[model samples]
Target: MWNGDGTVEIDGFRVYYSEVECVRRIFERHPETAVNVRPKNQLVKNAYMNNLLDLIDIACLAPQELTEEELRDAENTLLDLVGVDFELDWLKKKLDELCVKKTKMETRGDCMRELDRMIVEQRQVLLALEVELKNEENEAVSDSARLGFEDVV
Candidate 1:
């Protein structure tokens, strides 16, 4: 005969009986049997619960499951775990802004270097011109002195 819950066994007649009844009777007769049985069931339940919790955690962290609120909370928790402030778009935007500012700074630095080079070149040209002017003035003074000496002689 088959007992409820689909367990089958031979009925009374010194023959097989319902497996379910047999098990039930075994547990009843040996109450200590429950000590073993309960832990097994509890372990299985705990395993299932742990698996579900992991799935929920993954879904929440990755924005793959759960509601929007749950995702937000998970995101916040993840950011907190990594010691970062939670801002969905902040990282990307900050990187872009920094890149733009870096380019501008590089350009400005290049321009400043070019200006410095030009200033150095101008200083060299001015020094050359001053030397040439002094040479011309010396020649003029020497010519004037020679003329005066020739007149005196």
Candidate 2:
């Protein structure tokens, strides 16, 4: 329940405002598990387990709602999980939405500005990934050439 201010008292324990907000998000995402509440200790354990499971899901299973920065940071791991072709396909799909769809749809003022910013960021990330791939390809070629000369000598 609610106890004045922004705090919530669940099972005789007072949780802070920020913690309640995080729990609210979790509950919103998992409404079925949110409904059944037993004791305080069990609720806490369940919440912890749910949070851990969510993290594992984000890292390994489904990567929904991942930001550009996160994808860039974990590019190798993601590529390993889903393959480079799949990653590129997904990125192209998102770029198409951000580039073509948004321009076609009419957005105004602040929303338009935010959308524009997002498009620019995504474009930059795509460019960087391309450059990185090219660099790696060049390095591999050079390394193979060096090994060939070593075998000759």
Candidate 3:
């Protein structure tokens, strides 16, 4: 860091050092990036953090101040932002709609499962009907033969 600006030497060239560590801590709770690259990741991280601040409107809170659920919710939101590839505004909208997205996916999956069950039931019913028809035909033929044999006697 030089003159309060983050700078680093890369390939014999000096450049602005990106703070991907901050992003990892907020989203993954780690201190370093997995690959130690992606200079733009820091920008996304800063914007996401700022947006969270604006959304929550709380600057500082003691660890004991927030419940477990609240802490998890905040952490999940940041994690969600890290996965978003769009602009900051889009990220905000996505965060607000995250719960709905999951619900929709789950509901669709349930519908698909129900349809599959119905198909299996229909197939079983059709098979049973075919067997019943075959049994009735065999009984009719046997009744006719018995009648003929009785007439001959």
Per-candidate TM vs. native? Answer: 0.37, 0.26, 0.40
The residue pairs in collision within model 2 are none
Error of 1 at 23 (Å): 56
Which sequence of candidate numbers ranks them by TM-score, best first?
3, 1, 2
Query: Please, what are the lDDT tens digits per residue for candidate 1 over residues 28-137?
Result: 54444224222234335334323323333344232222444543454454343223221224333333344455556668889999999999999999999999999999
lDDT, residue 128, model 3:
100
| Alpha-carbon deviation at 139 in model 3, angstroms | 2.4
Candidate 1 Cα misplacement greater than 4 A, ranges:
1-87, 146-151
- Taken over the whole model, the C-alpha lDDT of each candidate is 0.46, 0.51, 0.51
Clashing pairs in model 3, backbone N/Cα/C closer than 3 A: none
Off by more than 4 A, model 2? 1-107, 146-151
For each predicted model, how many residue pairs clash, with residues at least 3 apart or on different chains? 1, 0, 0
Per-residue alpha-carbon lDDT of candidate 2 for residues 4-80, written as tens digits (9 for 90 to 100)? 86667643435556576655654465444323333347455444334433433444423335555554544434333
lDDT, residue 153, model 1: 89
- Model 3 regions more than 4 Å off: 1-87, 143-151
What lDDT score goes with residue 142 in model 1? 84
Regarding TM-score, does 1 or 3 come out ahead?
3
Error of 1 at 37 (Å): 40
Candidate 1: deviation at residue 81, Å? 14
